[model samples]
Target: MNDREGGPSGLRQRTRRAVQAEIAATAMRLFLEHGFEATTMEQIASEIGISRRSLFRYFGTKEDIVLGDHAENGRTLKAALEARPADEPPWEALRAALKALVESLPYTPEDFLKITGMLHASPSLRGRQLEKRQQWTELLLPDIARRLGATANTMNELRARALVACALACSEAATETWVRSNGTVDMERAFDEAVAAVRA
Candidate 1:
């Protein structure tokens, strides 16, 4: 109730999200400690001092608990891009927003590895992850279309989607580089290089 480390002022929505993130983190730890399939929602809830039902209130399934809520990230990205200086080119704005986002990412490298490993182990989770990406792509497509002042059928639409796709590819490369470097690599630099590689 103390604004959770004196973060944002209003604690209602933010508090709920903070609690949810804690649950997700706790769940990940339990999964890793006790083995993924061996970990139970009840065990996670008990460890976190919450009822299993309360855990369910935040995440419908075990997979949801681990993935956390990525919608916030997508919204933050879109808002950051929209807030960029109007004079900047759209691609520049997107790249800047993404750089800011990578720096501000809440999940640690351990959490990243946990989720990545889980996705690799489970087909259902992999499908869901892909679905989530498609959903983000759909959201991005509209924003891009508006930025280009063109419909989805236009050449601008293709260019916009291509840019988003290219950005995603760069992000993937940056992430892999980050993991390989054991989080020692400058993620922003890797991302910048990835984008630069595309531009070259």
Candidate 2:
């Protein structure tokens, strides 16, 4: 057997990830059925046959479960942006990076739409999501700045910040539209249309 696959550390890591996934899945189900605000962490833990304390070890709060780990997500987005071809236009690179980000999402498309709709409708959840997304801006700005050949000059820095902010906003808009339309809207196409509209 492969050492990495069968080693104690690897085994423990795998166990922890599996448990985390289960907790998240159970939480999502409860949130959707009972409503995010109506659902309690203890209810989620009971449904999963784990203690509420154990659930906290995996997620600090219900919001954390719904949003996942934004810091980790920011790192992933930055890496994806860095992997884009240097010659690609900044806008094109950002669009491609967003596609990569979608590939990392945990839920099925159906669940995603439901969760997104719920999230957007919830003031607290939307605020929390926005706050977390704000942290991603810094991680993304460096790559965006490089792509634009931007500099520390105030206008250039603002331009870089604007581009990154626009990309994130487009992503959010597309997802919200997709959810609002009850999955009739093609999310990728909606995102492209938004980006094109901005460019125009």
Candidate 3:
């Protein structure tokens, strides 16, 4: 197990995080400008002033860099939900967390444009994104299952998966609405409408 307490291990972990952040930021910018498929892992590393081998050590694949944060975000959302007031409902907790998550994202307009374009135009990226979502669902469902006193069986798993999928769908719908409305509809508003649609 990794140690959270301060030590050499902690220091190394922090360094690793900084390196990953640097890599992701650079990769996203390049991917946005050049397109995902056109962007090479070597170019990403070169932009970060690192060797390709070192980049490989940090992220196994180009797709991994783009999709890696889903797992981290899932863990964070879980922890955030757990930390919320016990009286709060699960959906409410998730809603609040989602807003905070968007706020916490370091995405620039350029980054958003790239991701939105790629996700819309590229079937491969969409498929990869779905797989990443599935990975996130797998991480989050076990905790939710335990909370509901249900095992991680197919039915419970499907419910958990559905929750996340609906959330993403709602987010996407809201984004489309925002675009059509000339940015009058912010993502948070869209997310609210999306979640509400799901609840109803």
Candidate 4:
């Protein structure tokens, strides 16, 4: 809403995203404490000193809050991919991007585990997370398409999306393993293991 108000000015967009992340982080803590099914929009809204209707202005559903900032994180992830050396292979470059995402997020290991565990436990949450990954694939498409020696057009879109999807699945698998390990394993290394298993 705020982003739309000023026609997507950088400052307004960043300010709006900051508020969204704050709301999401606070709401996620509530989710961890009360459980996802038990937490309500009213409770999250009250905690943030906003009305339930106002909360909807930021996020459309309960699943969205706990899922975090997909668009913002997608941009962050794409930047990470873009920064990788041109000579690196696609999967290797994607690994770097995924690693960068983990490093850039505001979660401590305990907080991350709490949220991730909730994702594992809830069907709706897991579905939303998958949808977010799909969003990330679109954000990541053009650069990856270029890396594959293909232009990012209608003809090449499917090929590029497929490549990004595989990398995201590997990333997701690594994340699941990390949660199972109680966040003890290095994320990048976990991703490497998943990639290795897929190759094997």
Candidate 5:
């Protein structure tokens, strides 16, 4: 439990997460103000009062800095899926899980729109967003397989993957619709409509 034993203790872990969040917030602020392409790693590092080397220790690239929260969100989505009732149908469970995941997002609607707008506008960030979506699918794979009582067979694996992909597609459609409406539409309602459309 102690840091000296082998790994970081709870407090140390919290402190590290706090620092990472602070760094990410600083980077996002700079990205929004100066534009992602105009912002430099050195500028972000200097803003945080850390050397470029130290900044690299936290994030590999500028794109990684902006997309850093994706990892946490992926973990959250996976956890939400796993926490769904075992007796629930796969599609229903996935729908509820997706709702919980969206509701748990750290950003407000305006902030989410701003961040996604940046991602949509920047080629590098758009590529990173796609990469992160694949990562999210991978994270959900095992849970999807478990929920479906899938055996260790190619067909079963494919089924689980397909289901996860379906859920992701529905969520993406809902998100796009909400964003296009400029946050005027209720996200939960949009999500339900998308899920219903897919089920039909």
Candidate 6:
């Protein structure tokens, strides 16, 4: 068996991640140049010098290719939230986590606008975006509950869920405002205000 740490398995995982990133970059370029619906799996594979089957192995569908990084983002958010000091209030921890999430976006504001535009223009992508948000909320719920020291059935658990929801809403609003401003507005500041508003 291969060593678990920084061995063949690690190398393979890194390679896979690299290939996936390349595929996503290539697909985004094509989608932007052409249109999301006009872009095809075969075209993406051809541009990346990979077989169509290989592309399928990395991403099940065109929408998946566009939104694949969201899973990683969710993991990042969860980790950031969990890493917050135990003594911090739940809202404070959540605010920091949401800021971390924004900072972790792999693209610049211009690219974010392009990607968000593409999603807005495509009904399928918009649906997938909502699905991804729901997935993130679910991924974070248990951690939020844990941080609040609440069992599943406790009122504190309900409060934790509500706080998570508010944070998410604030994040969405901040992102939209930033995108609309063409990146002029400060996303972190917007998020901070949003969190503060929720707390009040």
Collision pairs in model 5: none
Lowest summed lDDT window (length 10), candidate 4: 1-10
lDDT at position 200, candidate 6:
82
Q: Report the C-alpha lDDT of model 4 over 95-187, residue by residue, as the tens digit.
A: 888888888988887887887888988999898888887889888988888888865577677877887898899888888888888888877
Write model 6 residue lDDT over 1-200, tens digit each, in one string.
57575889888988998888889899999998999999999999999998999889999999999888888888999899888887777778878887787678878767778887788779999899878988888878877787777566868777877878888888888877776777788888988887777668
C-alpha lDDT values of all predictions? 0.73, 0.87, 0.73, 0.85, 0.84, 0.84
TM-score of 1: 0.71
If scored against the real structure, what TM-score would every candidate get?
A: 0.71, 0.86, 0.72, 0.83, 0.84, 0.82
In terms of lDDT, which candidate is strongest? Answer: 2
- Provide the lowest-lDDT 10-residue window in model 3: 140-149
Clashes of 5: 0
Give stretches of model 1 more than 4 Å off.
1-22, 32-38, 50-54, 107-127, 149-153
Identify the superior model by lDDT, candidate 2 or candidate 6: 2
Instruction: Name the lDDT value of residue 28 in candidate 4.
Output: 83
Error of 2 at 111 (Å): 1.5
Best of the candidates, TM-score: 2
Query: What does candidate 1's lDDT look like per residue over 1-200, in tens digits?
Result: 44554555565767887898788778878877776678888998899999988888888888777555656667777777777876667677777878676667766767766555655567766666666655556556656666776556768788888877787678768876776776778877898898888899
Better of 2 and 3 by TM-score: 2
Q: Which of the two candidates, 2 or 4, achieves a greater TM-score against the reference?
A: 2
